[model samples]
Target: MTLAHEMAFASPQITAYAVEATEYPDLARRYRVTGVPKTVVNEHIEILGGLPEDAFIEQALG
Candidate 1:
């Protein structure tokens, strides 16, 4: 969540959304989200679970 917030702060090009899986079943299904704290970057990059900051950033931005 912090990374999402930081991305929002660091770049105007990025848009961050937080959604409840139960409420947005279609979205959850689309992303194959089976757990909490999943991050879908640019609608393609799927980073599952909590990660160390550096590792998360690498997967997210790389």
Candidate 2:
């Protein structure tokens, strides 16, 4: 996950979280996570489904 790299302990700039939607029902509901592989960036940008590495990185950063 590019977010991991960006938020790495070595040079942290952000916080990233990965939640199991089924395991954490409340979180899933709060985020309206109805599917797997959901990417939420900064609690604002959201990318559903999958994208190429370059595109994923781009979205994650933007």
Candidate 3:
């Protein structure tokens, strides 16, 4: 989550959002979130679990 915020800060093209599954049940359900720390990029790239910064950026931007 910190990385996401950092990336967003570093680049204006990037936007990051942090949503609590428990707080937004409908949103979580729509995203098919099954675990914490899930990252959905462009509404398609579903990264589940914590990842190293490089790997996370690769998957997110690649």
lDDT of 3 by residue, 18-61 (tens): 88899999999999998999999999988889999999999999
Local distance difference test scores for all models: 0.88, 0.74, 0.93
Q: Tell me the alpha-carbon RMSD of every candidate.
A: 1.1, 2.6, 0.6
Record all residue pairs in model 3 with backbone atoms less than 3 Å apart, i.e. clashing: none
Let me know the TM-score candidate 2 reaches against the reference structure: 0.73
- For each candidate, what TM-score against the reference? 0.86, 0.73, 0.95
Worst 10 residues of 3 by lDDT: 43-52
- For model 2, the superposed segments whose C-alpha errors exceed 4 Å read 1-11
Candidates 1 and 2, the one with greater lDDT: 1
Model 2 error, position 16 (Å)? 2.5
| Best-fitting candidate, scored by TM-score | 3
Off by over 4 Å in 3: none
lDDT of 2 by residue, 1-62 (tens): 55454545535676667676899898788878887788888788888887876787678789
Candidate with more favorable, higher TM-score: 1 or 3? 3
